[model samples]
Target chain A: MKIVITASGEGLDADMDSRFGRAKNFIIFDTETKEVSALDNSVNLNAAQGAGIQAASNAAETGAEVLISGHCGPKAFRVLKEAGIRVYNTEAKTVRQALDLFLQDKLVESSGSDVEGHW
Target chain B: MTIAFASGKGGTGKTTFSVAFALSADDNVTFLDCDVEEPDSHFFIKPEITGNEKITVPVPVVDSGKCTGCGRCAKVCRFNAITMLGKKPLIFHELCHSCGGCSIACPEKAVSEIQIGTGVISSGIRDHISFYQGLLDIGNTKSPPLIKAVKKKGDGASLVIIDSPPGTSCPMVTALKGADYTVLVTEPAPFALNDLKIAVETVRILGIPFGVVINKSDHPFPQTEEYCRKEAIPVLLKVPEKRAAAEGYSSGESIIKIFPGLGDEIKKAISTIKKEAVR
Candidate 1:
């Protein structure tokens, strides 16, 4: 299953990038296949804002099953879920840990409300 | 015609220009402040609210009995506002945008729509200006919903002035959406110059013709004029920096009253904007 995770390298085994709309990097990884790669987040200026959605969509298009992130805004959260992608909400967990949690079915899916950077 | 005063950056005198210009021209003009998050325009134009209407956004409501743990609703929701766990669906109101897609996609028809109060749109009346303002309820996340309600109060007359919020976001878009003209209020500082560019971009994006009005013209920033000229942005009027003028604003008094010539200046600005808009 394809998956996306919002991970902080320090605490969460995840990709590292500058602030959304401000960052220019995306570190992608596949825990099950142990594959890792990086995609440029600076595709375009306007796309900076729509990055989360783009990343999620790209992941889904690649047949990824889940996306994990430290936090997701309401708009991006909606976009990812609407794309038939499952979302795993985590706090300060490494990307690997989050992926592990999801693999173990221990990751909690958000009923929204915990997403940040809205309004 | 309505004139909306806006700037992408805050503290750029959106309220000052909006209220002053409204009071200067139409004695009976309606002033609407669509900046529900921080509505400071009322401080200058004090009007008693005559009417108010609650604004609500639709959110998802799940019926536990009907839900079959199918997770279909959760899968359809783009906002992740709904999640299925162990034959139950959890619905979060704040994350919902009221799109109703989840309800439509729900195979079990268990997901229904509910109203979430976002804010209130109020109508107030002073001596002449009919005041329509939106007050986003505390803790409410959205301001566009309330701004839409405020814009509805424009009765299309000699003058309808709107004081918009200080950002290039949805609320600002809503405030300036249908205005015949937009008056961008800014200072003569670097911050003002940068934000004015953003505000200009926003206005242009909305296809609205706008002019720049330097609030504190006497300030030492020479870039305001240079920037406007470079961008081909019109500078309608320059209000020289004056202590008495600042005092009036500080005391919540209209600048036109303190400086009688301001009324004429604002009137001219409106005419220039209209002529340019039609041209």
Candidate 2:
């Protein structure tokens, strides 16, 4: 299974980003192959509006089965759930630790968005 | 002729002076409170609303039966108001700018537009003044559409006084877009002067004939006056601050009642604006 972790930098050692919509980068991890690839999310940072919706679409397009971020917004959560992707809300200090927690089943799947979408 | 009153700084007497101008005018003047978010001029005008209607914006609605799951509609939306998941697009109307891009991008003609009410525009009369105002629904983010509707209500009036919202952004531009003249209300204070410079830049960019109205001018802040003089902008009116006027404003009385002498000053300001707008 592929898992996506929102990160502040491009790699396993980068800090886990607190925000999911305007996150700086995404670190995709392939559990079976132990492969790591970075997806830059800088384009959505200054988006005039609906950054969460665009970010959700981007995360789903990466073919990740699960997304791990500190917080998820309502609109983004709906999109991910519709795309058959599950989000795990966490405050893990770094991407490496988040992956470990996910493997150990220490992260809880978010039933709904923890934050409201900004208009 | 249409004249808009705007102050980049909030609470600098934009509504006060504009309402005063409309009341002092000898002819039947239309008053539009384009500050849909707050719409405070209605408190001053006390208009007897004769007509009111909801204003709406068009947002995309996808036809699930006709959609091809191609995600073209989602791709074409600049505002990301539409997002496709599992071959279906979810429309977020709040984020929609009503550009109709998704409808245009649909290949199978699955996308259609629907109207969602964002606010209400009202029109009526207060004596010789024809009054109009837009009241944005609480928690609704779309205001430009409502402001436009309010402005439309005052169309064809010989004299129109538009009280625009503060800040030089979309709302302000919508109000001042085609005005014959703009009165940039300001005060001789630090924060007011800072915003006044930006407001001046906005009007200059729009190429609208504009003058400054310095409220609370008795203050010793000579910087505002000096800046206007150096820029060659006309100081249309200098209304000294008065406690009596403030008391009258709180009680919802016409400003002319508090300061009877102000009627002549408003008349003079109108003449100067007419002369400048003509050129």
Candidate 3:
């Protein structure tokens, strides 16, 4: 299964980006293959508005089955849900730790957006 | 000629001067209160609202059956008003600028436009003077479109006076666009002078001939006059600070009626604007 994590930097060791829309990078890790890839997201960091919508489309197009982030806004959550991507939040400090928690069945799926749009 | 009265600072007496000028014009006069956020010229003109017309702008809707889920519409929308998720498109109406890019970008012709009311225009006549006012709906951030609707009523009138909203932003620019002359009304104060400088730069950039009207001229702010002189900006009128002007405004009366001799001053200012604007 491919898991997409919003990260502050490259690789699984990077910190988990709290902002879903303005994250620095999206790290995709394949659990079966143990392969990792990074998608640069600097274009949306300075967006005047609607960064979440653009970021959601970018994440959905990646064909990732699951999304892991510290926080998600309503617009991004809606896009993820419609794309059949279940969202999960973890209190883990790093992307690698969050992935580990998922494997251990410790991370719970988000039922709805935790914050309003523009948050 | 179309004369727009604009100011960068709010409550700088843009409406007061615009209303007085409209009343002073002997030719067919149309008063457009373009400050949709807080239109107040109607209080002074006291026009009998003949009727109201709803103003609508086009927003895109999708045909579910025809949609190909190509995501082209979302890509074309710059406002983030539309986005696609697994072939489903979500529309956020408030963020939409009604640019119609989505409908034009749809390859399958699945997108169509629907009219949505943003505001209303009230039209009436106070004796021989025509009056038009735009009242925007609460929570609606769109005012330019509403201002356009109100400004259209002045098309055939001999003289059109637009009372623009405060600030040198989109609302003020929209109201002042295409005017033959713009009267930048300001008071003798620091904040008003600061905003007036910006307002002057905006009109200069737009290439609209403009002059300054110093309201409350009795105040001891010499820097404003000095700045205007250094910039070579024409000082058309200086209305002395009068207690009656404030008292009359509170009672919804124009200074032209409350203060004697002010009517002729406005008339002279109009002639000067006509000379400066060159038709």
Candidate 4:
């Protein structure tokens, strides 16, 4: 299945590169075939408030079936849901750890979010 | 008459101007603070909310007895708000937008809809100015619902000044929509200029007539004037970069009270906007 992961680019490390809205890129991965591609989280050539939806929608247009992010805002969540994508919040990590967790089925997919105060 | 004060970025004096304009009107007006995420206008106006209404939206609640372990709800849900693990579909109410598509998409007809509280819209009065504001519930995703409730508090006769949230996003869009005219507030700085350009584009796209009000105008920046001249957008008013004014704001004093001419300027602005709104 097609999937999108919001990652803090800590250079493929276990620690999250940064907080939400500060992620370096949204990495779109494939579960069935294990392929991966990424889109920059930066909007307007700079970090913006909540680029998750734009990133996810771009991924969905490429047939993303799932979205993995550190956290997401309501606007992004609404758009992703309407696009028929599943959202999962994973452990804080770099892009690679997130994808690895997803491939190993170790990532616990959650509908409830720990993200708050997202504008 | 409702005049909306909106900025593309925060700390551009939306609340400061709205409160000042309302205080200066010298009439029993209402100041509606639509910034639910951080409704700070109340801090300056010091209005105590007298009435409040909860804002709730419908969200899907799965009835496992009827779910049948099928992943249709999960598959159909676009937000990943519902997931089937083992034999039950887990519902995340916070993430749900209450679109009801999931209930309709479920062949088993197992999912039901329920109300989830996101925030509250409240009404209050401070001296000559009546106040209505929306306070978003922590952990809630939706804000426009609360904004709509706050908008309903206006009586349509009294002068209604709206203190809109920062940014050119959905919340700002909802608050600014249907306003007679919006006062684009900004600073004379590079960051302010960039954000104001975006704000101008947003208002223009929405087909609303807007003019610029340069707050802290005396700041050491000429780009604001240069940009306005280039864009041909009118400069409605200019409040100099005065530290005393900043002190008054922090100390909760309305600008019209300290600076008498502000009320006159705002009245002029209202007249101008009224004339433009008719066209």
> Which residue pairs collide, candidate 3?
none
Q: Name the lDDT of candidate 4.
A: 0.75
Error of 1 at A21 (Å): 18
User: What is the per-residue lDDT of model 3 for residues B61-180, given as tens digits with 9 covering 90 to 100?
Assistant: 999999988889988988888877767887777778888999999999999999999999999999767999999988788799999888898887778999999999989999999899
Tell me how each candidate scores on DockQ against the true complex: 0.07, 0.73, 0.47, 0.08
Model 3: what is its DockQ? 0.47
Ten contiguous residues minimizing lDDT sum, candidate 4 chain A: A44-53
The Cα local distance difference test for each model comes to 0.72, 0.90, 0.90, 0.75
Q: Mind giving the per-residue lDDT tens digits that candidate 2 earns over A1-119?
A: 88999999989999999898899999999998999999999888778788888888888888899999999999889888888899998889999999999999998898999987752
lDDT by residue (tens digit), candidate 4, B128-186: 88888899998665688778778888756557789998999889998988887899999
- Cand. 2 Cα-lDDT: 0.90
Chain A TM-score of candidate 1 vs. true chain A: 0.64
> Chain A TM-scores, one per candidate?
0.64, 0.96, 0.96, 0.70
Better of 1 and 3 by TM-score: 3
Model 3 spans with C-alpha error above 4 angstroms? A1-38, A63-77, A84-119, B218-220, B240-244
DockQ of 2: 0.73
